[model samples]
Target: MTKRSSRLDDAARAGWLYYVAGNTQDQIAVKLGVSRQSAQRLVSLARSEGLVRVQIDHPIANCLELADALRDRFKLKFVDVVPTDPGSESTITGVAESASAEMERWLRREQPVLIAVGTGRTLKAAVELLPRMDCRQHRVVSLTGNIAPDGSAAYYNVVFTMSDSVNVRSFPMPLPVIATTSSEREMLHAQAMIRPTLALADKAEVTFVGIGDFSNDAPLYVDGFITAAELKALQKAGAVGEIVGWSFDSEGKMIRDITNDRVASAPIPPRETSLVIAAAKGPRKLPGIRGAIHGGLINALITDEDTAAKLLG
Candidate 1:
């Protein structure tokens, strides 16, 4: 036999023994009557020569099962469940990483798409984790106001982060999250610059947002976006959660209160967007997440395994 053919046969044998038979290098060396170094070289040759190809089947069976269950139960278009420790902070981090990956995938699509984003901690975290990419073809628009009462950009604003990360043009709603009154909100929405951005949001192919719970410890309240009295009023109005700064009741129906009218962001119906992805995870967020799902506010979700189980329950 030719020398080259003999080497190929030895490589195949070493690869089968090491990979398929699950034998150690030492065992392969002894069984093949070769040194350990030679056995290792043969396996490497097998890989390089395409005699053996390694395929890593990710052991994400549990996560896939949960994701499938969530999709089926909520009739959602997509669902991703990430593993995490037994805590809200860890859960948030896990979900953010997963959501970031999902966003990267969408941004990499060949067809240019508009992405509408909302403000909140979880969404902000996801944007922070997003890898830098030059996706100038895709445009990003804010689904909520960028400014705060103190004349500073809202802490959780996603426009700047997304724009910088993707190096894309962004349309920010240059307004407060909540105007002083419904009339003022109307005036702000009427501005030519603001109107165009809001209009673009309505046409967004995908929307990413963080669901906010109505509890006392809610991020909105803790972040000083809303007063204690305002929070109490929302709770009294049966508010369970919010999406894109629009408060909704336990059934996910928009709560028509002063706050709703004063909200500066244009409200896009959940079903109108091709994809509404929400990044959130925690015990406190359970009710809001559930309400959002039931209300069809979000067709896709990125959350941790613990939250997924609670949601299934």
Candidate 2:
């Protein structure tokens, strides 16, 4: 083999060992008989040269049909449905894999695009699976604050992850997920540090958000952003789902109740101008996903086959 092709082979091997086997750079260097820096460069070369691709390539017929039907029903801009493992009721892995596929498409674009992201467990999973790339042309901004209720940054926030994964410019909202009161929320929103990020989020052409269900294990409540009294109050007002802390009722109407009055999340972009894509699934999020679709909080969806079927049903 030529020297160039031999180098490509080494790079590919390095990538497989690092990404697939979850090996550290030192481990890869030891296995490949190369210096640690060389191993890291080899892995980066593999990804940049297109020798590494991580995706769920299967296009099951039922999933296709469901995706098509969902797109038609909601007038969505895009949709991808993947098969879920029979053993798993929640398809977090499958949804994350599919979301990473779509996110990669945007990250590969040459022209600059403003991409906004919301925080959640599934979104965090998606960012973790993304193959590292150099996409400094695009900008990523967060729709929700990175701060959790307990004063620590929320571990599930995806903006920092996206920045690290793609080497893109990232704007993170350093405020709390939700303020303790409407006046406190206003004060945070007025802060100069976070307003630009929120404004940029409003103009982002592509948005990645997570649909949160108002269930017994609701993310906001579980994360301590909302109290039990707040939860019961919102449910009493017909709230069923939330996107970026903005709660909505089952009929897909944004509720202007207690939690929403104090939410610090950026406003959902206009659906006509932006592609608000979300990755969500499982029985818990079914109501919220459906509500998001109906209310125009999101215009695109990436989910599992079973979830899609139930959404259409």
Best model per TM-score:
2
Give each model a TM-score. Answer: 0.79, 0.84
Candidate 1 local lDDT, 1-313, one digit each (tens): 6999999899999999989999999999999999999999999998776566443346477788999999999999889888757534554767776777778887898889888888888788778766668888888888888888788988899888776567877888889988889999999999988888988888888888899998888777787778899999999998989887788887878888748888888785346555888888888788888889998888999887888999998
- Scored against the true structure, residue 147 in model 1 reaches a CA lDDT of 89
Give lDDT tens digits, candidate 2, residues 186-262: 99999898788888988999988888888878888998889999999888888898888899998789888588888
All candidates' lDDT scores?
0.83, 0.87
Off by over 4 Å in 2: 1-53
Q: In model 1, which runs have C-alpha deviations exceeding 4 angstroms?
A: 1-59
The backbone clash count of each candidate, in order, is 0, 0
Error of 2 at 230 (Å): 1.1
| TM-score, cand. 2 vs. native | 0.84
Each candidate: RMSD to true structure?
A: 10.8, 6.4
